[model samples]
Target: MRKARLGVFKFTSCDGCQLSLLNLEEELLAVVDLFDVAYFREATDKPLRGTFDLALVEGSVSTERQKEEILNIRDRARYLIAMGACATSGGLQALRNWASLSAYKARVYPSPENVHALSTSTPVSDHVYVDYELWGCPVTRNALSEVLVSFILEKKPALRGYSVCMECKRHGIPCLLVSQGAPCLGPVTRAGCEALCPALGKPCYGCFGPKDDANVESLLSRFRLMGLRSEECRALLDKMNTYAYRKVQGENRS
Candidate 1:
């Protein structure tokens, strides 16, 4: 029997999600045996050609080149999964959309005109259809494995729709917001990665993106009640998953 062909593509990102796959180490070998890696520039030098059974796309679409590349990849791949916060929700770079990109470019570069980029860094779904999405700033290895196995078996991936608060409760970890006065996004963020950050005594920065039914307004109110400034709340939501947060906010108002 022929194995499924898998392609891993990247655009503009820290490559953390891709690194998560490499961190799999031994499990990666097992995954390799199950799928033929048609394209993975980070892992191999071999050129990628033709269509693939599954394409794991990382990073946000920030340029015309990325837009075209994503469309082409989507057309060729049987399953297109947006991997990581960048591909699923525009990543931290999407914060630029909240401000003037031209001004930002002028301040950072001597020749702003030379910088060829889109006004907004957008998620892959904005450009083309995405079969599925694996969230997180740099997705967890377990989630990656689950998604791969589920896709191969033609079964829906087992991802949670609840908030990270559930995981915190499951692990018997103290509520950082209540105890330490740390602003935690856990209540509104998706449940995954086993509540890693909160368990480490750090507030969640919402690396897993928003849950299916995130209450952004209530969360914002909670943050404000905890003495977090409005600007800080705005900045917090404007991070990696700004688009997703904005979408929720828009929905709340409408």
Candidate 2:
């Protein structure tokens, strides 16, 4: 059988997600046996050509050029997978979506006029159709494995949809919010990190982004009741997955 053609592309990101794939290390041999490994400069200096069976794209679209590239990739690939928080939810840079572009440029750049950038960082889905999204700051290798195996088997990958709270319970970790009064996004954030932070006795940073069933209103109210100011509540939701949470409007905007 002809092996599936695989490609990995990067944009403006820390490249941690790609690193996870490379970190597969001992297990990578298994994946390699199945795929053609068509294009991936991060793992190898391989040249890219022709259509791909699957393209795992990282980073959000922040430039007109990348927007065009993503569309073209979507057109060519049999399937397009947006990897990590960056590609799925515009990443941390999406915080600028609501801010003053001129002021932001003036402050961040010495020659603001020379800056070739957009006012917002948006997810890949904003520009093209996505077959799947592997969420994380750097996507977990386990999730990547599941997706890869599913694709190879011609079956849908079983991506979880519940909140991280379920993982906390499964791991028998006490609730930080209920027991310690800590502001934990685990109640509203998606599962995948396995409650890693809360397991280590810290609050969740929402690296996997908010769950679709996330109750942003109740979470913010809980924050306010716990002595967080309006601005503080707003700031809590303004991190990496800012664009993914749609239920946070009208808070601290008076």
Candidate 3:
């Protein structure tokens, strides 16, 4: 049988998600035996440039070039998966969506006019039909392996739904939210990291983005009840998936 063609693409991201594939290590060779990794320059210098059975894209559409690039990728890919917070919910850079781009460029860079970036950092879904999203700062190897095996079996990948709190409970970790009045996003942030931050005694920074049906407003209310200021609540929600979370009604965007 012919090998299934696979491609890995990157955009405006830190390349952490791409690293997840390489981290597969011994299992990575197993995947090589199953598929023809067509384009992943991060792994090899001789990446094939053509249509693929599956294409995993990392990073948000943050420029006109990337906007056009993703469309071409969508046209060529049989299945396209947005493989991290950057691609699915705009990543940490999405924070700029709330502030003035000019002001940010002026404050951060030495030459503001030389800075070339889109006004908004948006998810892949905003510009194209994303077949799936891995929803993480850097997608976990466990999920990547599961998705790969699912592709071979011709079954749907079991992603989406489930909260970080569930994973915390599963790991027998105590709830930081209840035990210490921590302003945690575990209840609203998507599960997959196995509640790593909470287990380490820090509140979830929403690195996986918002879970399905996540009640940002309710969480904010809970934060306020815990004596958190408005900015504090916004800051917590304003991490990797700021724009996506801000869309959750009942909270003020400004």
Candidate 1 residue-wise lDDT at 228: 86
Shift of residue 47 alpha carbon in model 1, Å: 1.7
Q: TM-score: which is higher, 1 or 2?
A: 1
lDDT for every model? 0.91, 0.88, 0.88
Clashing pairs in 3: none
Model 1: worst 10 consecutive residues (lDDT sum):
234-243
Rank candidates by TM-score, best first: 1, 2, 3
**lDDT digits (tens) for residues 69-123 of candidate 3:** 9999999999999998899889888889878999999999998999889989999
- Candidate 2, pairs of clashing residues: none
Candidate 3: segments with Cα more than 4 A from true spot:
250-254
Clashes of 1: 1
The model with the greatest lDDT is: 1
Count of backbone collisions within predicted model 3: 0
Query: Which candidate do you rate higher for lDDT, 1 or 3?
Result: 1
* CA shift of 21, model 3, Å: 1.1
Higher lDDT: candidate 1 or 2? 1
TM-score for each model: 0.97, 0.95, 0.95
